[model samples]
Target chain A: MTDQTTNWPDHLTGDAQPLEVGILLYEGHTALDLVGPYTTFALAGMKVHLVAETLDPVVSDDGGMTIAPTTTFDDCPERLDILFVPGGGMVYKPMLDPATIAWLADRGATASYITAVCNGPLVLAAAGLLDGYRVATHWASRDQLARLGVEVSTERVCIDRNRFSGGGVTAGIDFGLTVVAHTLGEKAARFAQLVMEYDPEPPFNAGSPESAGPEIVALRTRFMAEPDTALRNAVSHVLEQRAATSSHPVSDENADPAAGIVND
Target chain B: MTDQTTNWPDHLTGDAQPLEVGILLYEGHTALDLVGPYTTFALAGMKVHLVAETLDPVVSDDGGMTIAPTTTFDDCPERLDILFVPGGGMVYKPMLDPATIAWLADRGATASYITAVCNGPLVLAAAGLLDGYRVATHWASRDQLARLGVEVSTERVCIDRNRFSGGGVTAGIDFGLTVVAHTLGEKAARFAQLVMEYDPEPPFNAGSPESAGPEIVALRTRFMAEPDTALRNAVSHVLEQRAATSSHPVSDENADPAAGIVND
Candidate 1:
């Protein structure tokens, strides 16, 4: 058994083979979106790999903080127990990257649970994995996400079948706990929750657009205007390309990476 | 102004100077503890420098994730607006490192605010910076912090003069928002709050000892018992060393780094 699973109960350890989680890392990805869920999974004694396109460091949305990716696309596991994507101010880069979208579509097909937090659902949407699923995204991106032809939920932790997603940046914690509970039982989730001291106390009542009032929401909207527009444009372009190339849809049986690449 | 602050109002830019924040990075530190506050600070238009002993990538408590430090101790700004630390499962390493303590002591003496989240205050207490100050820490480490002669508050975000601290791993978000609210105005904090969607909905009520009840708390306590014991021993040793070396105390007036190092 790995050192990470030594203290956990037998049930949690899965007979000494811990749960393998792959969290996608990309430039401009929000740190909290990744770290929130990563901490919970780590505490749950799961093996997590920060998967990126390259082995080089991945710079987050917040310019200065850079995270070294544990595994690259060429080396990540074929099937992750849980595949997660984190949202960012500029998720369009990854949403439009063919390599990232292909990797997600490939691994996500067999993953036990396909998940995302914040605007991360947008990335999954870009990969066509969350096409008909009800996914949650950052409040600012809900409209843009809806443009991608997916059902958008306003809930914090929206679990629609196997596609579990969360709202906004800080929502990843709530989303992580919910996923843990679903996969590892409520006891384990509650245990991880206490470990993280997941009780939140927001200093202000400006979390949502309704609560933040008009002025603050407008300010944030203005700040997000460019990125929101970029995401919309990227969604439009990806949809057009998907339409152009997918005139003859391939059967799901023959759509695996081992067979042939089928985006839709 | 830098790209990070372009969206912010003129008042926050500080005449084109952003808030210079130095967050100490050490091995075994919790990823969420650092990332939570980092997201907030980044959104607040602050210049955050992840300072470490060296420029090497610092591995977090979660073994797989590694973050590259932005600056080294020698290269860090002499005076920072905020000198912060984040707690971890093995903070005893940094707590006992003389260079870390000395560096914190030197920079902390002049920083406008010396802040920490979770057991991070324990590091400050070890550096002789929190002596006689009221602080907050992870619920599990409150007693250990108090043993170092600092008053411990059970509040999530505890502010005592320039020493601001938070409770546990997830409290860093609250701590960051509180720090931003204190340094900047409520407007900036609220703005950042809305931007990040600070609204939290914990899927589980088991966040604190009280809310988690005795059973889950016991599980967490048992898990933390070993590290808790180590922290106690480290605190005892640091206190003894402080007593032994400070028999003849030099005045703080003459204790600047330019003259000689005076810890305590």
Candidate 2:
């Protein structure tokens, strides 16, 4: 992978080529996952393109918001400084889509940085991008990621080699800043932070399951039951694909065993 | 002035009316200001409507993204659980627009909660909504907000009566979580926080002037020179209008005499 540091000169007082960032947009992806990093990178003067299969507006998981993609998969820039994927309820659909997976595989091969937030890393894992790389993903999907043979980091933002992954949705902002710091320098990242006022103060100390306590965690788990089923099914499909491709037959050790039962 | 707590029954285990939130969308508004809270509130099950003057796509200040409005100002629901406004480079344009100000005045008068992020409070103040109310706004716009006779709070999120204001762009998420806690209760807000992974970890601690040190602050100040002039002109225009309508002339003491001059 090309070192982006060479592209951004030390004395970037005025002259510097705009960083080309391609953010994957798909149906039912969480809006915040895309917008958080989009806002951060845009503030840092990066050229961000919301890329999808088509130019149509992509409806978010909430079904209340629609974001139009700036470029189609076929039209996206050949070389991108950053290639990012976001995760949401319908993430399983994209994980199973051959076209989307192929796009990721092709882009991941040459992009200076490969990144994902939330369940987005699952899509990358399904695409075989995280076959051996350690990554971070939404806490709810850590077990699923480990099942895919990817080492899951507990950090909010994890950077392993050229791959940057963030935990869940809002961590995209943190991931974006880290990327900026690496590519554009800490000063540039801090300038973007100051512009966006990225100092966060949560009114409650319940952003994580550990802090949210048992009752709230149980409630959240209950609320996510439907999505969890979809995710499990998707995981099974990926595992079956891996088994079919390899000479070795499907073994219990290769699967979660508990969640290996394919629905349908 | 109606209490929203009454609308949400105490035993909201399964049954609860969706919170109707209308986020004002305007040309040249900062995308993060609206997106941060929109993501938080949407995750919390709020029916967030991107309300704007038209159904056309509203381009953000950076011109890198465009957000299509879900509903026009005239077509928005008459009653809303929360009414929000975001701020950016052309924030002054909306602050001076009669139609936008009229819509804000009308909706703000009856909305359960009135909110703004960044310099958005300047618009609220322009509509006379923040008159005699303590509020929070972007640090760069503090002097501009105080010039409007609104008491500026140094807190990241300030709630005065029914008016909830947030400091700068990223403060919207904190403001949204606070609103969720107040309306749907703490558990619901915490659930939303967990889902979004709202635990923020910025790589740099230079989010505010006090934190960024004087050198970065000076750089930011220099960067904001043009927008500052536009804001001052807008403030002067609002002050002139106030004087023309009231028997009392525009008092030098009421203005931030330092920035009361309209350059053009």
Candidate 3:
């Protein structure tokens, strides 16, 4: 994809196969966030692999889509082209799971792209990958990203080279398409989009918080009151380094978030 | 489900645990056709049990997603609220599998919705479900639908009550959105649409056979030459037989194709 933000992998391991897209699924995670990008990347002909902490099923937040992982963290493919992180109400738990966080951080160290949807970027922030980088995620998590020292935006989708971030679950398609253009090439991306009839016409106009109008946003925001507090308190503690990392290089463990995290 | 363009089960075992979603996976089936809707119902809190004919990993047409199934046909969930029929290039093989066709026909007789995507409607047609009903399928399959005596259109999505039809792979999202609207209340669906940010704004305006421009359309048309011939012949064979049921009765093998199916 020769788009505004992309970097084609320069080399491929003989057994590397095609670009492998690994999506992490867990309990209470929003199913749409994972499935949306799965559709887009799979449509684009990328090798999309659904992964979990174990071989068993990873249940979604609402008790929807129970996906069985093809491989476990211990048996993931040698590497990944893109690592996708999806959000749900229980993200705090998954983020705190050392196995899950280490997997994201380890993979992000060398993966072609590390992306997140909804509040998923928070996980990345907690992992220290977002330090000194611009990122985006769900609008509700925008301020938290600023607190993590990353340039955050309310855009429906953001593609910052190796860091792909989406506004919400629906942005997965756009993120996928854009990533497709970046990874496979524009022609192939266009070809896949054409075949899938990706030209979407939403019956209603509302989508993002900014786009969904006032009272609706207020009601939605009000609904999320509990999770917001939980995220702030839980994240501040579990991903404790958020305090240190924000004030210092991600490598530092004593940085003060209040003093160091960016606001403007 | 009341429309009865297809069969509804005689004694549907409303057992919640056993109802499974049998997703067809093979090379060339559009990826989104399965995954998009997979998450939709999954988010709505339904257990989307993935079923295949075998235990082998299923490869998609574009070689993108290699999905492992939860169960095979024989071992699948016995009772179900929905027997989702995902569409793609592999749909043609369902006609070749009496076990699958019979399973679809049997489960469809009782399941809540016998939904299909892209060319999945053809599987419904192959199972003699679309007979005498206004059914929809992929845009490229319109002519084949006409040959089968069903009214055809290029609408991005079509929902004939029990038989939800997605226009193409990407239409799965729209279909899922519509399904949420249908099964759950509009409020629940709207809530999902809001979280998903489902107001899709594709970078490119190409998604339909007609909308894909003439050259690309012609290329696709040429590419489909072989499938068209086979589909035409197979569909004709599926169209044979004489009905013996009453005017409003169900499960007439030679059911009229133009009657039960509605025009939207």
Q: Return the top candidate by DockQ.
A: 2
How much is the lDDT of residue B98 in candidate 3?
Answer: 76
Docking class of 2: medium
Off by over 4 Å in 3: A1-17, A25-29, A49-57, A68-81, A210-230, A242-264, B1-31, B42-83, B110-114, B159-163, B218-264
Residues B1-264 of candidate 3 have per-residue lDDT tens digits of 332212111112222222245565544566567777876665444467677777766666545445566677777766666666666665566665677777777767777777777777777776767665555666666666665555555566775657767777777777777776666545445555675677665655567655567866765555556766676666655554322233533342223433333345
Q: Per-residue alpha-carbon lDDT of model 3 for A9-30, expressed as tens digits?
A: 2211223246778888777787
Winning candidate number (TM-score):
2
Per-residue lDDT of model 2, residues B164-239, tens digit only: 9898898988988998888777777888898888888888998888788887777677777788899999998999
Give Cα-based local distance difference scores for all models: 0.83, 0.83, 0.65
TM-scores of all candidate predictions against the true structure? 0.90, 0.92, 0.75
> Higher-DockQ candidate among 1 and 3?
1
Could you list the iRMS of every candidate?
A: 1.3, 1.6, 4.1
When summed lDDT is taken over every stretch of 10 residues in candidate 3 chain B, the lowest stretch is: B4-13
* Candidate with more favorable, higher TM-score: 1 or 2: 2
Superposition error at B57 for model 3 (Å): 7.5
Give lDDT: candidate 2, residue B62: 75
For model 2, what is the alpha-carbon lDDT of residue B160? 86
Query: Which parts of model 2 are misplaced by more than 4 Å?
Result: A1-14, A249-264, B1-14, B252-264
Of candidates 2 and 1, the better by DockQ = 2
Predicted candidate 1 versus true structure: per-residue lDDT over B1-264, tens digit per residue: 124324345543355568899999999999999999988888877889999999999998757789999999999999899999999988998999999999999999899899999999989988889877878788888777766767778888888888899999999999999988887667778888888888998888999888889988887777678877888778777767776788854232212212211111
